[model samples]
Target chain A: MAELDLDSADGRREALRRMVTIRAFDQEAGNRFADGEIPGFVHLYIGEEAVGVGTCASLESDDYIASTHRGHGHCIAKGLDPKYMMAELYGKAEGYCNGKGGSMHIADVDAGMLGANGIVGAGPPLATGAALSIDYQDRDQVAVGFLGDGAVAQGQVHEAINLASTWDLPAIFVVENNHYGEGTPVEKQHNLDNLSDTAQAYDIPGVTVDGMDITAVAEAVAEARERARAGDGPTMVEAQTYRYRGHYEGDEEPYRDDEEVERWRDQDPIESFKDRLIERGELTQEEFDDLRAEIEASIDDAVEYAQETDAPEPSAAYEDMFVEQPPELERFANVARTDGGANGGDHR
Target chain B: MTAQAELEQETETMTVREAIRQGLREELERDEDVYLIGEDVGVFGGVLEVTGGLYEEFGEERVRDTPISEAGFMGAATGAAATGTRPVVELMFSDFMGVSMEQIMNQMAKMHYMFGGKAELPVTVRTTEGGGMGAASQHSGTVHTWIAHFPGLKAVAPGTAASAKGLTKAAIRSNDPVFVFENKMIYEQSGEVPTDEDYTVPIGEAAVEREGEDVTVVATQRLVGESLGVADSLEGDVSVEVIDPRSLYPLDTDTIVESVEKTGRLVVADESPLSYGTHAEIATRVQEEAFFSLDAPIQRVGTPDTHMPFSPPLEQEVLPGDDDVRAAIERIA
Candidate 1:
């Protein structure tokens, strides 16, 4: 696996492009959901792109990551093709999960993206387990579990961190504290102000970083990844981020005011990162516009591909239930395979 | 000699505990990715001593002990299985499944299907169940029915030491997640286990412990042995056939349905509760396939829908045994 060279101009440009791509992909997803083109609800990662891109920028090609429900940004950051992810969201056969998993459960294990889980706090344990596998296999790789602020209160998340710490497994936990866990505020959800403080209980290093700043998040995760690889166990890095969009696409968002959303929008991650790159002479304004245009076109192509793809056949429901599909399912499989209510059909 | 006869000739007489331990040891030796993780599974040789001497032989890395955190380790095992490794995790008691229910139901069981078949979880969860040693309600409850009923999980409850070794090996080798439900009381019961390391009893197959024409007794776990005993005693009068449907989920319905067709009378016996349990599932499948073959109404032999009491008499009274099997057989046969 090649070392992540985020400090290099090429690496920085690539990181910014990924963040922009995430924003464009999610923006398209939000519009599609509102237009009723996409079937299910979508939690846009529009505002929290930096957290995913920065944290993932610290990881090598073979390192694993388990993501939460708002997982499009992480999927993009982890190098999953936007076309396949969009196809999954569109419930098409060409999707990552073959239409079985929609917006919430897109996964590409071969790409080292474990999954975008629907169940909150579920990814941490999975990430820890992946770390266990890495340790057991004697691999020089680490695992990262990305969770939300709401997941901080979950007992299983703490259990995962504790287990990872105890085993000295190469795992890094980056808490994407996007202020609200669903609709509730972080303050009400947790007693501790800083979610990273929860790491102290496990006797591991804990730090908080500016999630809006990609560089800050990247540096923090890179350090944590180093510690993990050096057999220093797990580290908790809380990224103080905010989501500009509603919890879900159609959410009325009765919990928070418009003023808070506007305030968060003021510190837009992509805009600030683009400005930082221009200021650093790493990127020109014209170059940034070209990058944005290129990303927008790719997103447009992904949406088109997803729209053109076919829905999985009805019988596909029985497939992939087990490596060797069980005989008990065969009775039902026959019914599904039959065209109409002639061959022992309409039993219900 | 033929392969079957050759394999049979090299049999070793061992208890169920020893059979399971031998299976674990063979798998650990066979696959570098295979590891044992659970409470008291290492230095203490397992809580029930089922994994006795494994820790010494395999060392701490392969035979690892963990804190009594069921959800953590269970979730970790699921993750590890998905990443690449076969983790045979023990939950100490079947009752402890509640603590890790989220991981089992949401993560471990559904990962493959939910991920559109991209992920393969080669995880085996081994736990103890059944009532006999006065362990009371929590520890001794027969919960194999729950795991069997759960989607994406294959369950096996062995009735003999041979099936115990075979099923344990099969579960560990399986690419999908499997649960081996061991009856705590049967660990001491000795039987002939094939000495071959590669020997495995395929999942979704049943073994006809005894063959008869009068009635068919479909049983699981300790009840399989009990039904066999009842079949032996009622050889002349009832001629009871005992069929151990070891794998509960992908059940060998053909074997069970054939036995019911031959016998014409059915008695489903399991240590789980009578209603909405393993008995109901087996009964439903049998009646569905061999409805016309039944000469009489099917009878069920299992614990009444209640928890096992602490008292010896109450515990024994609530627990189903050979007497229950015989009575159920007499009613239908």
Candidate 2:
């Protein structure tokens, strides 16, 4: 319920910082993965940062959020420690999931981050349940599931929205229609042009936002949040965004032409937002440079921290499977301890 | 009030449906945080009538009727569980578990472990199992085996009215995710159930329905009653020890193993498919624990790896009954 007015200088500055920071973190992650410094397939949120940042800006810190594979921006926007997130991507012990969850599954439950799920259409139900929890507990906070356009066609998404609508739960569904789902374009994957239209099935208001414009996305999210808190049920916000990177770091991207990527790149949210901030005199050229430099330094610090952090002990894998580890698991744990860990345990 | 009158009130005979309904009512009244959420669970009093009269008593907020969105609501229950509220959800039919298996398997089963044991998924999923009502393959599946076999989930399929009430209460209170598979055919089956507020059949424990020394009949759900009837009919010919393993996941192998050790023979009767099922698990565990005590080859009574056919004749043909249990006991005896 707190204010996040981008019209204000402080709000605009904060938005710029988030966008710049996301760009820095993702670009670095992509580069490091190529350099073999970070393991696993990295889904860079280079261009779609505005959607996550702007949407999250409308949410309270206590509100819950579920994210997708391309989720670093969401995690950062939700106020998760970038150091831990970088450490997780680096497969270090200090990561949010204690290094058990890599890039695709980083979660901070205490911070109300349900998780960044690897499975498509998996988050909406979780967010819906969270909203149900809030309703049950009589809490004012809302839960948001930030899914990609690809997940729009998933049957569970329909079920989740329907449940939220029927229960009048305080949930929001944000579909980042980033022109493509994995290698295939959204147009090819979906029959409808606007993913928001799918909300009609749930009888909730659905809006399409210019994802390149932070203010528009923020406004839509703010409105949805208001509706949720007012017990008006769920709303769907479709952020028409574009991703600059491939689905993964090393993707060949054979499904699309370079021209299409270039066209989207020209409307890069961070750059466009920065230009608007400058024109409004809220951000000067030197201030923009300072913001970029500040974000870059912070990202460098996170990278260094991740590099220096230790990988989890091999035996830690045996833990966290149950609240009270069953006797069978205890036997396995004992063996793990005695055998100096399992196959490839010594390696990250 | 005299002690006998009060005791009679506590020991009033009720059907499995009434017992389960009582359990829900007691739990609902016991905890404000606990509520029911499922399709037609609220206003319709549940399609099976298991949750009959709960909506009128608790009102809409507690007795929520969900859209036909199992995955959504199941996941929502998981989410609600992780947060704070204890949600008693219904899947309507065990056969349709496939529709929500993603949530049931991944989110419900793995969340606590995946969340590094920070979460307590106090969610009770009640669904009807078994076939006899001519509902066919899509509606009538004794699929408790899948849940019982799945790690991190506590599965219970109660037989008698007492267990129906006890297990439901236990599941509502357990910190872990508990799947209660109710056989639709036994809703009318009557037994004396304890009306005591504190009564709860512990998870992972088995109850010996009848004591005998010739052979141990480890049955689950509806099979327990059928097996008990089998034991009654063959009283002069065979001495069958019927043990209902109320909870399946953290299976009370000790009870079954001890019973097999005493009887020196075993017949695992479950409504699920015969191959690689609850029967197999029970049989295997008993063999492992009491192999030397066995006097004969272990027999399993279950559906012969076929779906519950639509017609009454076909369903009866596939469905395991007292005769099958008696036959198994006759061989073991």
Every model: iRMSD: 2.6, 6.5
Number of colliding residue pairs in model 2: 0
TM-score of every candidate relative to the true structure: 0.97, 0.93
Candidate 1 residue runs with Cα over 4 Å from true position: A1-4, A336-348, B1-7
The best candidate by lDDT is 1
| lDDT score of residue B280 within candidate 2 | 84
> What is the alpha-carbon lDDT of model 2 when measured against the actual structure?
0.87
lDDT of 2 by residue, B211-306 (tens): 888989988888989998888888877888899888887777778877888999999999999988888887776666677788999998999999
TM-score of chain A of each: 0.96, 0.95
Q: lDDT of model 2 at residue A175?
A: 95
Chain B, per-candidate TM-score: 0.97, 0.97
Those runs of model 2 whose alpha carbons end farther than 4 Å from true positions after fitting are: A3-5, A37-39, A331-348, B1-10
Q: Write the per-residue lDDT of candidate 1 for residues B1-333, one digit (tens) a residue.
A: 111332455898999999999999999999999999999999999999999899999999999999889999999999999999899999899989999999999999898998899999999999999888888888888888888888899999998898999899999999999999999989999988899888889898888887789998888888888888888888778888888888998888889888888989998888988889988888887777778888999898888998888889999899999898888888777
Candidate 1, position A96, lDDT = 97
